[model samples]
Target: IAEFNSSRKLIPASNTKLISTGLAIRGLGPSFRFSTRLGYSGYISNGTLHGDLYIIGGGDPTIASGDRMTVKTDSLFAKWTRALRVAGIRKIHGHVIGDGRFFDGPIENDTWSYNDLGTDYGTGGNGLCFNRNIQTFSVSPTTVEGKVNAEVTYPATPWIEFRNCAVTARPGTGDNLYQFNTDLAPVAELRGSLAIDKGQKKESFSNKFGALTCAWEFAKYLEKLGINVTESPADIDPYDNIRYTEAWGKDSTRTGFRYGNMAESPENLTLVYETKSPSLKEIAKVTNSRSDNFYAETLIRMLAKKRTGSANYDSCKVVIIREMDSLGVDMSYGAQIKDGSGLSRHDYIAPEFFCRYLKAMSASPVFKQWLYTVGIAGEGTMAARLQGQSESLKHRIKMKSGSMNGVLCYSGYVMPSPGKPEDDMIIFSIMTNNCPEGGSKVRSFIDGLLMRIAK
Candidate 1:
């Protein structure tokens, strides 16, 4: 290594996924699936679910892409209504039984500091996660007023409250403090602000994230999808929103169902729904390719359930450590995987451990098939940096990039290296932590270096 800057045990940031993801693939195999079961307490008769409907969650993480981080009964209600309707059922006159038996851990990682959970970058493990278990809020400046009006993709009724102190500021500095605290989901929070550098007075806002206030939207979406309006639905979210509603009609049907029918026990309704876990490899790619923290957290929790028989991250740590040890990857490098997405700064990993993972994945056929194909400067995360560099460097680089507030890292295979002229496989891991410039700039710089190495 050339003259370096500072040398200490650094926070690997999302690079920790290199360890979690790689080991997850090796420990659980790339083909594993998270299972959710739909069981009935009574029988279906006269087009009505006679007893209660139990939507059991075995930690299926690939629910919704955004705003699903905090699961609202409404989003799930919509799917349930649609599914039940399709299955030749009309009314579910019973309680929506939430069987969270799969995960008995706290909503937030006990190891993670409280400050980070309220920031919205972190996620909670729920039997029901919609829209990727996160909510989105878009703010566009009103053409006339100096203030901006924001809209949630999934509109919530008792609606998610927001205190947008964000004003239309000058270019390069339009930022606001995005924060939320819910009586619901006490262990987690929805945070991050709408920052605009250059845009007209009007901009469309959207994110696949959950807000402490997403209950209103979920209710709205469900009603639209044909769920008979039912007294505004209960706010059963993990935030301070967990309240028991008086059981309707003696619990005749399942109200809070996740809507995914188990392969073994599909819905008893004539119109049952088949909810599938996005392939494990597909979810893995989202993290490696874009370093999606939400997906990473979800997958880690899901895998944690499989590994430790519990969905909580604490138990996940146990499973991850055990599996890592079983994989024969030395613990000398020492890593602490607080969450899958690496949003929690507590995540760490060594460089050689990083490279070892990449090389191992490169050798697996299933991984090779699911791993993302880089366009150099053509598309995806590498597109911007490879604009001029990737042209002559086609097919030479296939890698995953990761970043956090002040870090940047990349690890993957380089098709040809100087050492082996014909066809040599090269795996590299580079991470810079706690920089002032932020990780995006550092990521652009990393892409530039990778393109140069491709030649």
Candidate 2:
């Protein structure tokens, strides 16, 4: 209904997920599902496996994710344990391996800010993501002044060492704690302070060692079940070829096994069990509704892998451009798509492109499924937006919100009326970058604009 600086390139923040998600639906189809397999090499005899048990990651992002749409971690692990029991294997003479070489790239985008790299939302995508690639810790103030205590509380990070340096602040000061750690580092330093009266608070930090963490957690779980694991948990490392070859061997058994990339399993690997993720439709819903960076980044890489046989951020950019071109959506107007989740400040897209993309998706074969991925006025990120408005108005506004630092953006379709046809929907995008105002004020302005559009 209105437009200003529509062609100007601006940071879209999490709105970038819409582009990745749309391409995923168009390229991979809504029914597509990611798979993770449980298998073993060598032989099993007398209720013992002589070789390593493998959790081959198929780039399934939802495994052990704490989202409402996914299965619980313990429940999923139990199924794998049952599969081992059913196979009459009670002892493993080798290490539990997590093969996460499905996607070949750096976990975190280089363009992402260093500060964001340590936060939970900044967790990078990986072949075998567990617990959303985050580790949580409970922080509380101690009786001693200026003293505090912190402890790891989830998914068991026995490999990680915590160096708590946080102090206790005055009452009503709230939480100001921050976690700092290098990529794949075993030592993490907790800095900042917590309020004395704040009681206990849970803080989540990024986990760069997702694949190794996955292996370690599963090994612990197996040990709990009386399964003897003689060796430690290991993840496939590109530089550590000696260890890789030693684990699987270099004989005729290594026919289909390729170093560095394990997308294709070894020929002699016996399939114990397989875990299938929720369908792409369900995943996309969670991606946009929660603005999940992990899901979006993983989806884009999966698309790239499916199209060009390479799963990396560079290939993802190529696939996105090609797919957008196929849809006749012009992105040549100063648009830079650095990462799928828009965590990078370098990502820029004209608001006009979003409107065009949304319009094109409205006519797509999977339009109905794609529509379900965005946030409605009273749901997800839009829960508090346009509050106290009529239900009709609230339901008609279906869009995704993106906010970080000084950027806030919204883009989606606004229904013309209740139960109206897709053709009648109004596609819109409002992007605000480098605004000095607080998020609430910017959100209020955008909500007012949307309410007017709904009316």
What are the lDDT figures for the candidates, one per model? 0.51, 0.82
For model 2, the run of ten residues with the poorest summed lDDT: 249-258
**Which pairs clash (backbone N, Cα, C closer than 3 Å) in model 2?**
none
- List model 2 lDDT by residue over 34-112, tens digit each: 9998999778999999988888889998888877878888999999999999988999998788877788878888899
Tens-digit lDDT track for model 1 on 45-137? 666656444455556665545322333454555665667666655544443444444555566665555545544455554655445455445
- Looking at model 1, residue 123 earns an lDDT score of 52
Task: Please state the error at residue 61 of candidate 2 in Å.
Answer: 1.3
What candidate 2 gets wrong by more than 4 Å, as runs, is 143-147, 171-173, 240-268, 419-422
Prediction 1 global C-alpha lDDT = 0.51
Candidate 2, after superposition: displacement of residue 310 in Å? 1.6
Candidate 2 local Cα displacement, residue 373, angstroms: 1.2
Q: Which ten residues in a row have the lowest lDDT in candidate 1?
A: 204-213
Q: How displaced is residue 146 in candidate 2, in Å?
A: 2.9
